[model samples]
Each structure stands twice: as C-alpha cells, then as structure tokens.
Target: MASDLRTQDIQNPVDVAEYLFRRLHEVGVRSVHGLPGDYNLVALDYIPKAGLNWVGNCNELNAGYAADGYARVKGISAIVTTFGVGELSAVNAIAGAYSEYVPIVHIVGYPSTASQKNGMLLHHTLGNGDFNVFSKMSKEISCAVSLLNDQHEAATLIDNAIRECWLHSRPVYISLPSDMVQKKVDGDRLKTPLDLSFPKNDPEKEDYVVDVILKYLHAAQNPVVLVDACAIRHRALDETHEFIVKSGIPTFVAPMGKGAVNETLPNYGGVYAGDGSNKGVRERVEASDLVISIGAIKSDFNTAGFTYRISQLNTIDLHSYGTKVRYSEYPGVRMNGVLKKVTAKLGQLNVEKGPKPNNDIPDEEVKSPEPTITQAWFWPRLGQWLEKNDVVITETGTANFGIWETRFPADVTAISQVLWGSIGYATGSCQGAALAAKELGIKRTILFTGDGSFQLTAQEVSTMLRNKLNPIIFIICNKGYTIERYIHGWEDSYNDVQEWKYKELPYAFGAEKDSVLTYRVSTKKEVEELFLDREFASGDTQKLRFVELVMAWDDAPVALKSTAAAAAKTNAEN
Candidate 1:
C-alpha cells in the first residue's frame, strides 16, 4: 500500500516544527500572526521554510484579533504566542472568535515536557508549578486542545485540532513543547493534504426536511426569506443564494447578516431587526404568514434587544445542525443539502412583489444651518459613495448601527461584531483583513471606527503600513462613547475620550509623508469633496488614507438609541 511504503521510506524523518508549519500552509494560512518570544524564537525559523510569512503584531491581543480578521476573509488563520502572559493577553480576542464562529488555530509555545514534569520554576509560569493552568483556561473557549508531549502522537493530535477548527468553525488550541520543536516525526504525512471536507447530511432525512419546507413554502401566499450570519459563517451562501433567487421570494437579512444578500436585488428588503428595522421592512416581515428563516441567530443585539415580533408558529427555521418546521424538528438534517434540494425542486411560486426596498440616498435636506454632519445624514450619504467588493469594517458602537442605512454595492463584504461586541476589535481586525485582501488581490479595504475605540488598538495601523497595505480608514470623531451615553451615562466623565490628531497617526507609525494621505473633514462640503476624489477611492496608487470624520458627541444612529435604551432597561431588571 502507498501508506505502508511511505512509512518505510528512507526519507521518513522530518522535524516536528516543519511538519506542523507545512500543515498550516496547506490549510491556506499564508501568514502567521503573533509576537516572538524566547519559547517560540527557534520555531519561528521553520515558518519561512514552510512558505508562511511571519506577521509580527504589536501585541498578543492585536495578533489574535488580526488572526480572527484574516480567518473571516481567508477561510482559516493561525496565531502563535508564548506561554502564560502572552496566551492570557490574547484570550479575549480568542473568546470573541469563538462566540462568532470564526475558525483560528491558536498555537502556544510552552516549556519543555521535562521542565513541566520536573516542576521547574519557569519564568512565565506561576510558582505553583502547574503547567496546565493556561491551557485549562483556554479549554472553556476552544473546540479542541492538543498538547504535544510524545513525538509519535504529535502528528495525529495536530491534524485532529486543525480539522476540528475548520469543521466546527471555531477556535482550537495547540500546545508545542519547546524541547519537541525539532524532534523527528514522520515526513510522509505531508504526501496528502488534510481531509478538510465537511460531513455530508443524511440523504433521506435531508430530503424529508426539504419536502416539509417546500410544502409550507408553496401553501403560503405571502412567504418571505430571511437570511442570517450562519449562512455566511457556515459557508452556505451558495446554496442560500440559489434558494433565494430561484424561489423569487421577498428576501431580507438580519443586522448581523448585512452583506449576505445582494442589496441591489429587486426583492431584497433592508435589515429586519424588529424595532430597529426600517419601518417598511418591519411591517412587511411581521405581516408575513410563512417565514423561511435560514441560519438565524436571534441574539439580544442582533434582534434589537430581543424585540423580534415574528412568531415561531409561522416560522420554519433552517440551521447547520438541523431544520425545524413549526413544532417538529429534524435533528441530523443540515442546511447545505436541504437548501440545494429545495432550490432544485422549487417548481413554481406566487411571488408577490412588495414595495421596492427604499435605497435612494437622500439629497441635501432643508439647507442645514451649519453643515454639521448628523448620523441620519451621514449613513444615507455613505450609501452613495460605496463601491463594489469593498471590505468595509465598522466598530461595535455608533458605526455598527449607522451602517444599516448604507446600501452596499454588489459583492461588498461587511465586517462587524454584533453578537460579540468588542470595542477595540475593529482596528486590529482591519489590519489583518487588509493584509488578507492584498494577498487575494481584493481592490479596496476600508474601516470605520470611533475615536475612542481607535485609541485602544491604534498600533495596528503601523502593521498595515509595514505590510505596504492600502486600506482607507475613517475615524468617527465622536468626543466620547456615544452609545454608552444613550445607555446610562449621559454626563459621566468616564465616557469621555482624550482628543487626538487622528489624521497625523500615519507619520508616527513610520509612513513617509508622500506614501500615505491624511485628511480631517468636518463640514458637508469637506466630506463631499473627499468622497468625490477619484484617486482616494479608486486605489490607483495603493496608498493608505486616514480620515478624521468629525461628528457631534451626542449624535447616535436611530438603531443604536433604541437598542441602548432597551439594554439599559434590561440591566435594571431583577
């Protein structure tokens, strides 16, 4: 057999570090993100040999964030960190990735197995000498944890960890002992790449579920399709798209599923987050008799503080795990197969066209007194300026809510943390996303973050410059945490942020004056002129551009105000 021959071959021995890095490279990890520490210093040498670039981040936390962004854009990513302190610093970002179902392989460089067994007092470890403390902490968030002790089992464990990370679409932790870095392992394992294929659904059960959905779908006169984050995260967009388009039903997306649907489609309605949805979308969805909800995550924030008005009695929910029709459930039926079958068997439907989703950007209104930009005017105008296929990331604050009004062009990829609303996540994430975009030859990468949030992970801008990445970044210059002010802290000093000359950060981050462009725009005229500039938006020169977009401290988007008020009330409950 080929396997037996490979095991007996003369060139069977290879360093464990080389094998691990090769596996990562095979799984589409073009770059590894993390800082170098003494424990991981030697292993870093094998990265180049495996055809992987080392993306040295400013800190471990930023590294984790960047890895997450890269995974969302590039399908899978990896990060390496030193033992205790480094791993702990990156845990928050890892947890966010876990909550949102992004796949990342977190590789930790640990002290040697001998040192751990002998109870040696390592510098990164506590005096108690328990070696498993940090990894045990990660156990809560990780889908699988592989601690490589014996050289013989290392390859199997590493393969299992990476396979689980991809299949589950969640973070997995792997431990590499310092002494085992160069230990010889079977070199022939790389002869075949990882078997990363997803498990197929049971054919009989899938067909039955598909039939159940189609029955209701045909019976109802005013049926609608609702798509959500899992459709994108679980890689069911192709099937979901086919079902939506072929069925020709009125389609809508949840707030977290902003970019899943082509907004330019005639049947595509705007966001449907109960109270936070545009008025027309809300009324139409609530009135529908049958709602085909695909890959839905009805979290408090995603559903506008649990304000979803649709009844489960009239809903048929399809998920990666199973499909549900009213009171009945199909346990093993996955969405991928069911969607494909339903789309294929969809013979006819009475497609009732509703009012076309209102997408027209507003003209200059009422000759505003001073041209001060408000959230209402800014979001709509943003719709007019956006181009196709742009990677647009928004902070988990006002920008997250304001982006709802922006009508994306076809193929625009919108990134935001709705369920896992981490404040400083966007800046670091932008760094990783921009790098991934560059590798994939994506034209433009853009980011919108609050001034307060930008201060937290502003160092990632330096990483962007170091890679020669050209993402257009917009810092929403709100003086303080505007969303928090609406929630409970109207006049609290803790909500305020120190003012910084945001546009001047590129020079501080080592970008030459001519290599980058910077702007500080306040009035409507300034924003208009900046948007109209072809060179800025066209990505012709591939230069990083930073803009300080000044807005009032008290201004917040309509959705944010409603969601924040609900959050405040929920906090006060017993």
Candidate 2:
C-alpha cells in the first residue's frame, strides 16, 4: 500500500486536476462523461492522461444522464462541465440521480479565485458579480459540496467529497476554479485508498433486531422475501440473494427491483405490483403470514397508486437508513450488515420450503382478428426473445409500465426511472449504458421507448452511432402520449405529437448504411418475423438494430390502465 503513494515526494506535487482524476480512477471510474467548455477544458485534458476515457457527449444534460447510467453499473461515475451555462444545464439530470440514489461526482469549472474576489462579471455568470449562486442552487440536490480555494486544503476536500458520494450513494458537487487546475497538491495521498467501508452497527441493537426478525421469521407459517430498487442502490442485492437461497423461501421483486435477482430460480415468483402484479404474485405475497421486504421504496408508481393490500403489522421492512419490525422502528440500522447476519444465521434456523407461488408465464392470448399490434400480444412475445445478461433500459411512459410484464434471464440488468418519471431519459442513458456494458464485457444493450419520449432527446442516438456502440432500440410508435391519455385526458388534443418517420431516424442521425439495421413492423406477424431473424437475435456488437413497432393509441397494458385510473381518480378527489 505504501507503493500506492506517489513515487515522488509532496515537494514535487502534481496538479490538482491530475490528483482528482487519479483518485477517481482508483475508485473505479474508468470513463468520465462531459462536454468541453472553456472553464473545464484544461481539467478535461487531464482525464485521458490519468488513464480514464473522456466520453464527450452532445450536451451537458445527456452527459449527466450518461454519468448516472454509468454509476449504476460501475459503482461510481464522474461528470465535468463548465461554469453556469454547462453546470446549470445538467440540474434536472443531477436531481434525478439524487432522487434515485445514484452516485455521480459533478465537477464544475469555475472562474479563478482572483476574479471572484475582485467581483468581475464573467460570461457564464449572471452579470451580478456573484459566482456563488450556482453552487448555492446545487446544494439542494447534492449530498456534499466543495469549492477548492487553498492548495493545502484541496486534497482533503476532494477526498471528503468523493467519500460522501460513495457513502450515501448520491450526487456530490465540486467546483474547480480555473486557476487551481494546475496548482500543486500532495500526491502522497494516492498511496492510501479512500475508506469505503460501511459504519459499524451498534452491537446491542443489532442483536435485538436480529432476534426480533428471527422470531417472526421462524414462527410464521408462510414467509416471503420482497426485493426492491434500494437493494440495488445499497449494494445489498448479493446478500439479499444469498438470504433467499439459504432460507428456501419464495421471493418476488417489486417493479423498480426488476433484474436485481435471478427470476429463473425455482422459488422465484413473478413481479409483485399490487393489482398490477402477475397472476398470483399479489395473492401469494399478501397471503403470507410474514413478509421480509428488503430495500423497499414504495412509491406511487411502484405500488400501482397504493393498490397493495398487505398489512403493515405483518411486514418487516429493511431499508438503507434503518429497519422496521411491524410497529417498532430502529434508526441507523444498516441493511448491508443486517442482511449479512441474517444470511449467516439462516442455516441454523428451522426454515421451511414454503408453497411455491404461480411462477408460470402464460402464452400470449390473441384478441384482435386482424393481426394488429397490442400490448397484451407484444410484451409476452418480447419476453421470449430476451437472453441472459442483456441490459434493458425502459423510458418513462409506456415502456416503464409495459416492461413490468417482462421476465428477465439470469444476470440481466434492468434500468428505469420509476420514481423520478423523467421522459427522454432512456435515449441519453442508452448511450452511456451501452458504453458501460462494453467496458464491463457485457454484450447486448436493448432499449424501449415511446415515440413521444424519443422526440425529446433523440440526438443522443448520433453520439451512440459515432462511438460505434450497438444497442437495439424499439420505438413504440403510438402517435401520442398514451400514458398521459390514461392519466388525465383520454381524447384531449394536448397529448398529441408530431409524427415522424421513426425507422429512418438512424440514417438521419449519421449511422452508416450497412452498419445499422432498421425495421418497421405494423402488424404482429411483422414483429414476430423480425424478432425471430437469425442476425437480429444474435446480440451482435458490430451492428446496431432499430425497430419501430406501431400500435393502437388507446390500447395499453392492463396494469397501466388500472394505475392510470387510480391516479386520475385521486387527482379528481383532491
């Protein structure tokens, strides 16, 4: 570990930028996402020299989105942008990362300290001579904020900022003044890696909570484990999976928890979304005498607008912040440690092989005689085409709701923004996710988005084409916002959008003619034919595939229709 310290002494220090990028590389950020701006250009140059790839995006917002996607896969990601114009442009994406608990280091380039002290108005500034405004705005979304002023304190500030980002699994803001980019700082700090270990739990509380959980878990006639998105965020998926395997209990995943656990396991039940859950998922989960929910985030969309019927008294909710056993709550109880302890103790307990819930995925039923495309017909067929280790990114509207019907193979990763509900996020995130997969040796990157959402940030596809990253994209051409129609207005003109030739988008976006494959399927037969093609299902990395699946505007997934109705009713009642 001493060799990890710089070969040179503190007297021969490296610039602040070099030190920061090296630290990021040590923490597992292989690539940095951002667009070049004057203030940050010098610091951006240090990225490649630090052994990190500089992924230049088309815009700052997309760069932020890309960073979030990369962080979800790589554990931590960094993004660099220029002053007010560039940093402020990424606010929405940063806020989404904050809400969903993604760790992203947002490094912004600021004017020199002398200019700030002299009250000089800069181009990116608001002309009010106030350079602190943007940093103040960022304080609301980031878990930590640091503006490096003195060279002596720069190393400590940078270390603390990154430490906070990893500890909380949230975004952190760092403003690097132009003058400080090349300032000498201690390189000896690099020898010692940042401390990433979780805090130790209170021994007394840990024993008491574990006993309480074991009491209910052992006494219950039928027990189930429910996995959610927080399990992924908190790095407890592996522990959660181990607990399920050792306990031999039935398990179900929430909507946001898709792909966290392998669904191919014998005791794995389908998704549990209250009324929207697969055939027997809701019934089996609610019927259980004890429910051990891990990393649960019960949002409106995730729960189908509060349609769940499970009793609070019968549930033990384990969260990142704490643990709850029926009525009593214990704060600061880490699930990371708790899950480990539970898994280790599972072998000693008398756990049962509970009754298996309905794990069958039924065949698609045909209702339309004319072979027209429909949600009931499309989602099931798509499920058959999915392979192991394929990463799927779903857009907010129809794609998010419809993907709930999907069944993933083992090791597949599913990424979505159910809680933030951001439109046009998938297109930007696909570019990053594909790159991340390639870095991690993952093969296929598949994306599903409605036409309305695609129109918002379609240009990111150009970035993908430029990078030669192959991601299979499906654009659901429904002519308008179908989810919005179900939520507020069924026939209002406000939900309509301008129609474009969806299949020709790749060509228009600069993809080589033979390098990419494009398809337009209007009927169920056409979709089936394309899906069954030998080359199309091969998960090829050399070429990209784009498909436009046209469907009826009014038709939607059964889950979406019911959830929309509930949301609409709530709106009317309020």
lDDT of 2: 0.86
Question: Which pairs clash in model 1?
Answer: none
Report the C-alpha lDDT of model 2 over 300-399, residue by residue, as the tens digit: 8889888988898999999888999999999999887888887787645444343343313345455446778888777767777888899899988778
Candidate 2 Cα deviation (angstroms), residue 139: 0.9
How would you encode candidate 1's per-residue C-alpha lDDT over 1-574 as one tens digit per residue? 7645544553788888899999999888899999988888888999999999999999999998999889988988999999998999999999999999999999999999999999999899998999999999999999999999888789999999999999889999999999989987788888988998878888888888888888998898898889999888888899998888888899989988989888888788788998998758888998899999998999988998898899898999988888899989988788888999999999998777754655464554435676887888888788888888889999999999999888788888888989988889999999899988888889888999999999999999999989888999999998978888999889899899999988888999889988898888898888989999888888665799999999999998889999999999999999
TM-score of each candidate structure, all chains considered together: 0.97, 0.95
Candidate 1 residues lying further than 4 Å off, grouped into runs, are 1-11, 362-369
Instruction: For candidate 2, list the clashing residue pairs, or say none.
Output: 4-191, 5-191
